[model samples]
Target: MLVPLTRQKFEQLIPRIATGDQYRYVWGKFSDFLRRLLASVVAVVVVLLLRWLLGEGFGGLLLPFGVVGGFYWLWGPVLWASLRNAQYRKYKYSGFFRGRILDVYISEELIGREETVNNKGELVYVDNLERRLNVEVGDETGFSIQVQVPLRRSHKGIARRQVAEMIVLSNRADLSNITKVTDIYIPSRDIWVSDYPFLQRDVFVEVSNRIRRDRLESEEESPRTPRRPPQRKEPPQLPRQDREW
Candidate 1:
C-alpha cells in the first residue's frame, strides 16, 4: 500500500521520541533529571565564583541566563525529536507490507554508548558495540529487507515464520535505512519494534485494513483469463463387454 505523506500525515503517523531501547539514550527520567540538576548546580557555582572574583552586579547580570542555560538538558530530547522528525519527513513515500520473519541476524555495532571514568577520574563516554538484532522479512512479492531492532528481552519473543508487517518509508520506492527506522509491527505479538516509534497503532490498523480491502476489490474487479474445461473419458470398453455377454 502506498501511503502518501504530508506534514500532518507524517506527524500523525510518527510518535514522539522517548528514551531507552527505542532510542539510544540513557534510560530513565531520573538520568535526565539528575543531569539537569547537576548542570544547574555547576552553573550556580560558576556564577558564585564570578561574584567573588568580579562583582555582584556582573554575577547578577548572568545569573538567570546561566541558570536557564543549565536547563538546556531539558530541551535536549525535544530538540532531538524535532530534528529527527524533519529528517524523516524527507521520506515522503511509505508503504505497509505483510511478511513472515525469514531469519534473524545477531550482530554487534557501535550503536550504543555508556559513561565511564577515565584515568584522570573525570567522567567520560566511549563507543560501545551494542547487540543489534536484524530480522529478515519477505513477502509473496519476492522482496525482502532486513529490519534492525533493539536487542531487548522481547527479542526472544520474535521467532521465525511469524507474520509481521511494517510501515517502511522511503524517498523513492526502493528500501533504505540501516541505522534508522520508521516502525515494524508484529500482529501475532501485538508489539511494535523499531528504532523510533513512527506508527500510531490504531491508525496503522485502520490503514492496513483499508489497503487490503482496496486490493481485494481491485482483484475481484479485474478480468481473469478463462480456463479450458477438462476432457471427459468414454465408457466404450465397458459397453462392448456388456453387449458381448
Candidate 2:
C-alpha cells in the first residue's frame, strides 16, 4: 500500500523532528548542563594556563574563549536542529509506503576504515564493519525493495513476515529504488526499529491508526476481488545507499 506524501503528514513530522535522537541538544536538561559545566571548567583552566604562559592578559583570553566556547556551546545545537528540520522538509514531499516484510536478515560488509594508533604509537587502519538489518518488503504491485538499516542490538528480534511501513524518499518518482527511507514502523507490535529514532512515537502511532483505518474503509467500499500474494522473488540487488542512520 502507498500514499503520496500529504501536507498533514508533513505538519505532524515537523514537531516530531526535534524530539528525534538525531537532533542533538547541547544542554537539554539539568544533567546536560552539569556535564557541560564540568567540561567547561576544565577547559577554562587549560585556557587560563596557556594565556599566562604566553604573557597574554584578559583581552587575548576573551577572544579565544568566546570564539571556541560559543561555537561548542551555542552554535552546535542550532545548526543540528536546522539540518534535521531541513531533512524533514525534503522528505515531506516524498512517498509513503506500507508493505509486508518478505525477508529479514543481516548483511555485513567493510563499510569503511578507521584510523587508530597502536601501543607502539604507529597509526594503523582498522576495517569498519557495517552490519545492516536488511528487510525485504513488498506491496501488492509485487515490486520489492530491500530496506537496509545500520544494525543495532535492539533489532535482533526482527523476523520474517512482519507488517512494515516507511516514508520513501527516492530519487526516482516511481519509488522503486529508494535512496532514503524513514524508520520502519511495526504497528502491531507497537515497536520501531532504526539506528536512530526519526519519528515521535505517539504521533507516529496516531498516523499509523489513521492509515490503517483508511485502508480498511477503502477495502470494504470496493467489491470483493481475489487477492494474490506478492511473488516470493529474491530481493532486488541495489547499490550501496548513503544513509545517515
Candidate 3:
C-alpha cells in the first residue's frame, strides 16, 4: 500500500534536503521563489520610479501601493507553505511508523478517471495515478513520512520549477515496533529535461497517422457500388442491311 507523507515529517525534512534538491524543476519551487522575489523587487522599483518622476508630491500615494503590492507578493508562498504543512501533520504521528525509510522514489503520476452519471448527479472515479518510483527499497512495510516542496501548478507560467516527493520505509523484521532512519533519498533534486524534444512530437504524429486512417477505413467499408455496365447496342442496322444486300 502506498501513502502520502505527514506534516511534521515534511517540515523536518524540508530543512534537511540538500540545496541541490531545491533546484529540481519538476515541482516548480524554484520558479515560484523567483516569482515572489521578482514581485518584491518590482514593487520597490515602482516606488523608486514614482519618486523620481513625481517627486515628494506623489510619494504619499505611491508608497501605499508599493506596500500593498509587496504584501501580495508575500501572500502566495505563505498560503502554499501552510497548506502543505497541514497535509503532513494529519498523517504522520505517534502510532503510524513500524520502521524507517529504506529508499526514496519519484515519478510522474499518470492520471486517469471515468465520468458517469448517477443518482448523485455526475460522479467521477479517479483510478490510482500510475506512479513510478526512482529507486528500490528493501522493506516498506510501515513508516510515517512527510514531504515538503512546491506544488506543480505553481510553475504553469514559469519556464522552470522545483518539485518533490517523499517516502518513508519501515522495517517489519521485529514485532516490537522500532523505527530507524535506514535510508532517505531526496526527491526534489531530479532535474527534468524541460526542453521539449522534437523527436517525441514527430513520433506521436507518425504513430497516430494524423486521424486519416479512420477516415480511409470508413470510406473503404462504405464503398459505393460500381455503375451497371452500359447497355450494349445493336450495330447500325442500316449499314448492316446494306452490306447484306
Candidate 4:
C-alpha cells in the first residue's frame, strides 16, 4: 500500500534519525555498545543455566553454536543502528545548498528468496520488488549530485527537470568534493524529502524564500548600467529681438 510521509510515518521510516531522546546523539554509540554488552551477559547466563539442566554432552555441543547465534541476534541490529545514527549526525552538520533537479528516474530491482533444498529436492521461487527514486540535482556552481529518495509507489508521478534544493556535505567552501545529499526540496510540487524527519513544511518554505532572495541579491550585485532619465529639452529661446515688448 502507498503511504504518505507523515510525522509518524517519517519517524518509523528513519528510527536512527529519531533517537529516543535528543541527547542520544552525543552518547548513542556508547549506549548501544553497553546495551549489547548487557544482552551478551544475559545470554551467557541463560545458556549456562540450560547447560546445567541438560548435562554436558548435549549442552556442550550447543554452546558454541548458541553463542554464535546469540551474538548475531544481540549485536547485529545494535551495530547497524549505531552506523545509521552516525550517518544522520554527519548529515545534520553538513552545509545547505540551493539546487535544481536535472533529471529523475525510477530504478527497479528484483530480489529472490534464498534457495532451500526441500524433501523432493525441488526449487521454490519467491521474488520481491524493490523500487527507488533517484534524482539528479545541480547547484549554481555547476556541481551536480544524485540523491536517492526513500520513496515508494507514492512518488511515481514525480517528473524530471523540477526545481529542487539540497543539503550537502563538502570538504571545501568551493564545494569541489561533495560527499552526500542529506535532503531535497521540490518547490513546485511542495514536496520535501530528506534522510531525516526534520524537514518540515515551514522549513521548506523558509529555505525556498532564502534561495529566491539570494538570487535577487546576486542579480542586483552584478554589474548593470543604471538608465539615466531623459533630460528635458529646453524650449527654443524666443528670438532675442522679440524683446520689442
What does candidate 4's lDDT look like per residue over 24-116, in tens digits? 322347677577667777777877878888888778686896686568534455455556655644432234455567888878767556666
Please list the Cα RMSD from the true structure of every candidate, rounded to 1 decimal place.
13.9, 8.4, 28.9, 17.2
Per-residue alpha-carbon lDDT of candidate 1 for residues 38-125, written as tens digits (9 for 90 to 100): 7767876777777788877687687776767677566555556656666765665555556788997788889668899999999999
Question: Residue 222 lDDT in model 1?
Answer: 96
Per-residue lDDT of model 3, residues 1-245, tens digit only: 22223334333433322222222222356776788778878888888888889998888878888887777555654455444434433333211111223434345664676666777887766565653433322323333343222224322222211222222323332213434222222223322211111112222233224223643686789969989987986543211011100
lDDT of candidate 3 at residue 169, scale 0 to 100: 26
Candidate 1 residue pairs in backbone clash: none
Better of 1 and 2 by lDDT: 2
Error of 2 at 196 (Å): 3.1
List, residue by residue over 1-245, the lDDT tens digit for candidate 2: 66655556645654533553554533367776566666666666766766677765665656678456634544445556656656655642455567788998888978899899999999999998888888887765676777677777767667778888776665554555666667788766655766545555576667667866766786799998798998888765432222111
Which one wins by TM-score: 1 or 3? 1
CA displacement after TM-score superposition, residue 77 of candidate 3 (Å): 2.5
TM of each candidate vs. truth: 0.60, 0.61, 0.25, 0.50
For model 1, state the Cα shift of residue 223 in Å: 6.6
Ranked by TM-score, the better of candidates 1 and 4 is 1
- Give the residue spans of candidate 3 off by over 4 A: 1-71, 92-183, 186-245
Specify the highest-lDDT model's number. Answer: 2
Q: Distance from true position, residue 45, model 4, in Å?
A: 6.7
Best-to-worst TM-score order: 2, 1, 4, 3
List pairs with backbone clashes in candidate 4: none
